[model samples]
Structure formats: structure tokens, C-alpha cells
Target: MEDSVFSLIRTKYNTLSPTQKNVADYILSNSEKVILLSIGELAQFCDTSETTVIRFLRKLKYDSYQVFRVKIAQELSGETTDSIYEEIGTDDDIADIKRKVIQLTISSINDLNNLLDEKQLAFFTEAIVSGGKAIFIGVGSSGIIAADAYHKFLRLGIDASFSSDSHIMSIACAHARKQDLVVAFSHSGESRDILESVELAKEGGAKIAAITSYPNSSLSKSSDIVLLSSSRETKYRSDAMISRIIQLVIIDTLYVSTVLKLGSEGIKRLHKSRLAVAKKKT
Candidate 1:
């Protein structure tokens, strides 16, 4: 529920009329600032009447502007600390950047705690443990995250693999069955190739789980479980810098949670894994 507002916006945005689109665009582009403003102020900024803003909220399934803003505040409050957008100025120093990074890391951790549904996460891990195979899909930086998650699960003895190559990923997913799990990653949840692969896996009956910044993203909608992350954005682009870090944090939590759930046998497996790697290093 902490992120339901975002999911709602994404789900309803395309369905809005031209007038609502104006309000939706303004709200999405300036969510942080919107949360801080009065409804009348927001209506004025969007060049719409007060009634339109209220109507937009209702269309998104929120009761009123007050309710919508409350959810937005919660969403923004969970963003990585370093994500506070600050303009580059002539007087800026290294300390400013350092402080921002520290705050961002702390914010990411807190956001992970707030945004992640522990029960849902645990169910996802359980699915992995019981799964016959696990396939991870992503592109770019998210591809790397997917690969890392694949390796983590592999080391823990879950059958897992990842592919950055879209063709290969699609082919691999085509072979997955109902007992398999496909964990896809995409910050925007709008990645074409990733979505295609997810569609293939679903048709094949594979259970799905998605890690994305937007809970309402297409990837999230298609998956059985969704994990949300927070990030800072600039006017033109939303960088994955902080969001990826938050995603990795969630992965770490999942790995550790799995270890705990697996108990003594899990510890034994981990020890054996460490020794095996150490021997290979020699």
C-alpha cells in the first residue's frame, strides 16, 4: 500500500481523457512537489479547475486530493536519501556529494524496509526454493542485477540462470514450465524485450516475480509477486543509480532470508560452497 498511489497513476494514466492527461502528467512529473502543495495550488499549476484535480484523484480510485497526497508523501518519503535533487552550482564542494551519497544509502535501506512486503518476499523465496528452475531476465544495468541474482540463487543450489541477450532469453523462457520461476527486472517496467520474455514465460506456465521501481509497471502486472524500489529523478531522466542499489538490497535480503529458512542444511551448503570456491581459486 505504501506504493499503491504510483501503481494507480500508472494503471490509470493511459485511460484518462485529454483533460485528465494534463493533471496526470503534472502529477507524475512533479510528484514530490505536488505532495508538498495544496490542492488549489496543484490545480493552478496544472492549469485546471479545482474540480478536475479532485476528479483525477477519483479516477485513479483515490477518495480525494488529501488521500492521494498522503500516499504520494509515503512514496517519496521512501526514496533513497541521496536522491534529493540539487542543482549543480559554482559553490558546490565534494562534501556535498559525499553527504548526499550517505543519505541516499540510508534512504534506500529505509525504503527497502518500507516498500518491501515481507510476506510477499518470503513467498517469492519459497517459490524459488521449491522451483524446478529459475530464469532471470533484464537489460543493461538491470541485466547485471538479474545475473547477480541468478548467481546468488545458483550458489544456494537453486537452478538459476540469466540472459542479457533478448533472443536467447526468449528462447530459454519458452522452455520453462509451471514449476519454474522467472524473475524479471526493469526499472520502468516498460522494457520491450523483458516484457516479451515475460509474456512467453507466462504462456509456458512459469510462475513470475518482478523487481521494479514502479509497482504498476507492465512487468509488475504480469508477475505473481512484485518488489518495489525508490530512486531520485532529474527533469529529463530518472537515473537507476539509487534504484538499482535499492533493488540489490532487496536481493540481499531475499538471499539471507532464504538461508535462514533453510536452517542447518542451508548453512552446511553455504560452507561447502565457500570451500569449493576457495579450492577452485587455488
Candidate 2:
């Protein structure tokens, strides 16, 4: 319910009637208090009627307000503790945790399938496949994405580097040449260091790609390509876990597509690199 509902609204926000859009925007922006608001309260806050809210819920597959509220409450508390598979009298049932995780992953896949644009994806694949070199920049948990992207590109026979440090990324970008590509990872797309790296790469005549939650964010606007991901927030867990998982999935897809686009040459290079790297281990 947390992200499945939000992603539905995001994908269809442009197509929604004004009233429905109002409800959607309000819900997305004020997600923390959604469980606390009654249907009428949400309608009042969103400047829409109860009908619009109900229709919105129905579109998200909720049978009624009560049902939706129960789900939201459970999500807020980190999932239900009163299930048959759950330990009795616990704050959270093990099955509930597993269900939430599975649901979040499923929602991510659905969001990616529905939201990814074929033309844009193809363009990005071509850019990456043809680029001379690639640099990945990320901070905090997003740094894991940068490192993973670096390895994926390396496996594809592309020369790629990653920097978790802001200063190091700037230095790398300063020397980046045309045909080089820079990719930035940020959950909110507002990370200042990642933005700076994109700017530096642009100044150095390098193409840029951004993986982020907000398509309208600064990082997205500054980049040559933007890959979108959804982040689900539960009360007990930060959005980073969901965001990172989605980021890795998108990166994996890009890696596979890059290999496909490069044909046999790419495959050969991949094998050579693996064997060469493995030799060092032996």
C-alpha cells in the first residue's frame, strides 16, 4: 500500500482529473499523516470531496475506507502482529515482515515496468554502450549503487570508475573528456555532491545519467538521461532500503542491455575480464 499506491498516482498523475490529482498530490506530499486522517479529513485537506478520495482508493484496489485504513495502520506499525504465522503478542510477526518486503519488491517491479520508457531506455543504452568511459557518483547508501554500477560497466568491458567521496568525484570529473559519461545516484535527486559532479562532467563535455526518485529534481534536469525508481516509506524503516534495491535492479537491466547492444565483442571482453580478474585470485 505504501508505494504501490504512490507509484500508481505518479504514473497516472498527468492523466488524472483535477480533483483526483489534488488528492494524489496531497497524499504523496503528506504521506506521514495518511493513517491519521479520516476519509473526510483527507478530502478536506486535499480540497476534494470524499467521492474523489474513494475513487482514488478504489483505483489502488482497496475495497473501502476501512480496509485501506487498516492496511495503512499495519504499514505504519511495521506490519501486522496478529497473524497465524506470527509469534503471539509480538510487536511484529515474522510473516508480516516477509510479506511487506515481498510486496515492496513486487511494487518496485511493477513501477519499473509501467514507468520505463522504451525509447529513452534505448537511447541510454546506446550512450552507455558507446561511451569512452563512465564515472559513477553517489553518497551514503547511494554509494553502494555507484560501486555496483561501476562493477556492472566493468563486467560489460566498459572502463568505469566510482567515487563515494565528493572531493574525489570532483577531481575525476575535472579530467573527464568527451565520450565519457557520468552517472549520478540520489534517492531524492537533491544530493549536492552528486549535482556538483554532474555539473563538472557537463563542463568537461561528458554526457550524464541520473538514477533518482524525483524525475523533476535538479539531478534529473541536469543529466542527459534519467532513470526513475520508487522509494517506499514505512514507519520503522527508512526509504533507502527500497530505493537501493530498485536502483540495483535498474542497474542490472542496463548492464544486460549494454552487453546485448555490444554483441559478441562485448561477450568476449566480459569473459576475458572475468578470467583475467580470476587469475589474480588464484
* TM-score (C-alpha, index-matched) for candidate 2: 0.73
Flag regions of model 1 displaced more than 4 Å.
1-91, 235-237, 280-282
CA shift of 101, model 2, Å: 1.8
lDDT of 2 by residue, 199-269 (tens): 88899899888888777789988988888886554566666677788888888888888888999989998
Whole-model lDDT, model 2: 0.77
In candidate 2, which residue ranges exceed 4 Å CA deviation? Answer: 1-7, 10-47, 50-90, 280-282
lDDT of 1 by residue, 1-282 (tens): 333465455445445667887887687668788988998999899898889887888887677778778877876787733224343345657896676566545645565545678888988879888847989899999999998898887788777888999999999899999999999999889999999999999998999999988766788889898887765443322447777888888889899998888888778878877888897774
